[model samples]
Target chain A: MRVALFASCLVDLFRPNAGFATVSLLENAGCIVDVPPEQTCCGQPAYNNGDKDNARDIAKQVINEFSDYEYIIVPSSSCAGMMIKHYPQLFEDNAEWYKKATDFSAHCYDLVTFLHDILKITSVPVTYQGNITYHDSCSSLRETRVKDKTRHLLACNEKINLLELGNPEACCGFGGTFCVKYPEISESMVNDKIADIEATGADTVVSGDMGCLLNIAGRLKRLNKPIKVFHIAEVLAGMTGIAAIGDADDTKKSEPSS
Target chain B: MKSKSHAFKQQAADALVNVSLQKALLNAKDGFIVKRKKAMDELPEFERLRTKAIEIKEHTLSHLDQYLEYFEQQVIKSGGTVHWASTTTQAQQIIVELCKQANARTVTKGKSMVGEEAAINDALEAAGFEAIETDLGEYIIQLANEPPSHIIAPAIHKSKQEIADLFKDHHKKYNFNSKLETIPEIVNEAREVLREKFINADVGITGANFLVAETGSTLIVTNEGNGDLTATLPKTHIVISSIEKVVPTLEDTSVLLRLLARSATGQEITSYTTFFNGPKRNSDIDGPENFHVVLLDNGRSNMLQNENHEMLKCIHCGACLNHCPVYSAIGGHAYGWVYPGPMGSVLTPIMQGLDEAKDLPFASTFCGRCEEVCPLSIPLPKLLRQHRNHIHHDKLNTSRSRLGLALWAFVASRPALYRPLSNSFIRALGWLGKKSGRFSWLPFASAWTQSKDLPAPAAQSFMSAWTQQQAKKKSSENE
Candidate 1:
């Protein structure tokens, strides 16, 4: 299978390891993974900001870049959701683009659902020894319905103990541009999320989306907490030897032995 | 009813720092979410019922004029008067006139958002008639002289201590001077105070959950049973509702009622779900002497013809508010309107001019949870996005953000330009923050750095590194 990876703009800039990990996992699943260099963003920021003309143009660009692939996979649920659920809506009035958009959306999947539901990979040959909790990004939990599929994969690793957050379904308030636009309320929300993560006593927290991971990890570091954050793809691909998100580069220097 | 929606940003900031309000919101958050889940989980037909309710509302709204006329005719047949008001001022005038004609001195009101929208209490008080709130939450906020912080739980922002203080201060006039300590004590005091007002009141006012066009009956579902008392105990009963509340039949109303309680409070049915057909009939023993239905348009007629027609399907259950993370964080008062949360964000802009409530639409994260939990599936986020589109088109949003988006979009749509531009910026930031892996503050990102540290970018962009890797792979293959 030929898979085009839409390593979201956040993953591309803020955390490249997650994108590389996603590529490794897809290759291991007997899929030829291609990272289309022309891709920049999924246009969520423009779309959610209500810049429809720009959003529409960006959507057309994204469609043109990845439409030829058998499957288009995104590591972040919100970006994938924008493509699969909202892209078609953006082109609804234009008959030709609407048809192309819908066809493009049908082939899109967020990474975890692609792996669990499509690839049917029950477990990965990876081991991580830690008490870890999961944060469900609002898009992942509600939009793509990515709950048990992620846990089902994570649970297959006997070395991983998944201690769930008190409210796993709650958003971490890294809502694309929401964190900056409404900084105070966003602070209170992410503070509540941090408290929930702390209550679990998990040394590490993992999530599928980079926006949430960045938000949670940034707050954790600011407060001088010892908790580590990783994208699920990084952990599942057995790439944990690299430094965790928002951690000093020297924190972990060894390579994965397996 | 006077919009503080314009001050939503400042109000939201203030709400965040309010210690007691935060506690109140935290305590109230999990109950609604958990209960609604359990209720839906137990009922296998809940999803099906939601679809049916939506269908019913769509049908009714499509023929709203015909159904409303039919409803009016049925009310006249039942010996009731139907008054139509196109604006809030007109609605207030109509209600005040009815009170004057009835020689009303004091009026008892059930929990009514329409009454809030019309500012009926202030209008009545200005007209020299005392209006008493009979619902416990409504009564508490009334005593505190504050707008309801929540629609269903009007005093949800108030802690028990605050309610006790209010009761202690206000109930002194009734010769009940003891400070209420327990939940029962607080509830019992409200019941006791309202009981006297219900009997002595010359006029009663309530909002309808649904208006059945076939029967001309007004339906109100309340856990407190106060709506029943407010609609029946007085000599005159006046139902304050919007035109969109009308449905074709009792069966359609029943479909909505099933979804309402479960979504609003997680009850299979409210403690009281009463229907009022009209005034007392000749064969009836006891009921209101006069019945009047004050159906207000209040921008809903415009809504019916526009993109916001789906919002009129809302039963005022407030399920969306209960599940909203923003509402949970700041509570409803921060939204600064009669309605709050996702629904209010959509409605306030349309009802109270777009410029007045511009920030309300942008206040949300567009998290999509509100639409997920809405029994009617109102697509709240889409409606909010529509408001943003309007704001953008009308240039109502801040020029700085608009310029920022335009600049970003220009580059983002051009991948060839965006790739290298983003690559260099990421590398520069990555080099700067290599030690800490984060920044406490940045030059242009103060809003983000204000509350939390901003995570630093990786040393190289993923696409840049991927290109390097691909070149290496191709060279090795050639070798």
Candidate 2:
């Protein structure tokens, strides 16, 4: 299979490891990968912030950059969802561009969905051992329907123990620029996300999107939490020799399980 | 009086901006959203109910002609009258005619989004009938001469102080104390004033939460019992609702009710989930002598046929409103519609023209809580996108917004120009924003920079770094 890698802007700058791991995973599955040289932000930031013009402009750039790819895969479900569902709607007026957007949407798939649905990579050869909790990013879990696929991919590592985070689909307050714009409500929402993470009793938390990782990690850092936060790709990649962040103590969650 | 949509937006903006109103809206927002989420989270049958509700709406809408005919027949057979209103004008005309026919001097109304949709009170008064809104929220706003700020809550935007003031000015004829400032006090005052209208009025006008075609009944679920009073007290009971309110069966209505109140107020059920099958059946002595259910189609029949038809599944729980950040920021009034928050954003464009109501969709943060907590699971953001898509395609993006998008599209599509240009742009912007790591002002970007800071981008773009990472990852794997 000829695959095009859409390592989202966040993965490129803030968390390159998830992006790299995705390329390695896809290549291991016997696929030819192409990295389009001109990819940029998906414009979700400007788009949601009433800067539709900037959003659409960036969307056009994104569409034109990888419009010709046969199989476009991304480590993040949210970005992939932006391409899959939102792009076509964004360009619904300009028939020519709308067609390009739809075609791009067809080629685009979230990493787990691409692995599970397209490649049929149910389980991979991986090793890990710990109680792990998973946070389902809202756009992917609900928008792209990546919940079970993501879980299945994580469960591929037989040595891993997957603990279900309370309210896994609850938003983590990273609504693009919303955290900065409405800092008060955003803090309140992230506070709830942290509380859920604390309830899971997992030494590590894994999520698919880098946007969420940064948001949750920032919250964890602020609260000075000891639990490690890693991208799902990093978890699927696994650590060979050393323990991951926050591995020293398996702090038990105080609450009785419901 | 302002249009229902504008009145809501203006009042909501006032509430959202005020420290006290913001505090109250925040309280309401958190209380409703949290409880609704917990209730939804706990329900194993909730997803199934959502699907069932969708199925009910789909079936009801697809066979609307048939179900409506059956419903009309049943209403007539059960000693009631059924009126078909194709437009708001027709609806108003029929209602006015009913008031004339019955010589109704007063009308007691229940909270109704459809009534808001029709602007029926204005018409009722134009026809010389005094329409008294009986729902406490509606009554507060009715005295203030404003629209319902929230669906279900109706007067969700108003504080008790506003209600107290409204009562002091409007109901002085009864010598009601102006000092009442509590929810219970206001409710009592509204009840005391409206009780006479309910008793002495020759007719009642209420909106149906759901119309059960299977049983030929109108269903209204309210905590305040205003809907029940409005439907039963007067000699003539008139149920007015949009065509989409109809469902196929009582079982379907039950499925929706289980989700509605929980999604609405976190109640297992509303205090009064009344199903008035018909009026004055021989066994029913305490009911209205004449029962009339005026089913209004308005723009809904057209909306029912569109790709965005899924919105009609809204049970008016206001779960979407309570969870919406924009709705929280501006309150229901800013959306400038009868249905405020996420649900109203979708409906306003369709009912009103897109050009007139372009700002509603842009108000959302695309946070997705509305979809998550919705009992019927309506994808609100997606529908909002439809409104924007129309606005965008037609070049109706807001005056300043159009030029910005055009420039962005121009620059982004051509990276040879965009990369170096944006890099330089970022560099200049970084210096401009160095004082606080944020820009207080920037040409064309001031709107954003005003509310929030535009963080400086990394020295390199993601594309350049991804290329470097890719080569390194591949070689390391090969080694």
DockQ of each: 0.74, 0.14
**lDDT per model vs. reference:** 0.90, 0.73
All candidates' chain B TM-scores are 0.98, 0.91
How do the predictions measure up, each by TM-score? Answer: 0.98, 0.77
lDDT by residue (A1-258, candidate 2, tens digit) is 888888776766544456656776787789887888787667776566445666778888787778777888988888888888878877777899888888889888889898889888866657667888888888876778988888788877887889897666567766665554444445556667788888988878888877777667665644567777777876776532222221221232211110
Candidate 1, position B12, lDDT: 96
Model 1 - which docking category?
A: medium
- Sort candidate 2 into its docking category: incorrect
Off by over 4 Å in 2: A1-4, A9-34, A41-75, A86-137, A144-258, B1-15, B168-171, B178-183, B419-444, B465-479
- Model 1 misplaced regions, further than 4 Å: A251-258
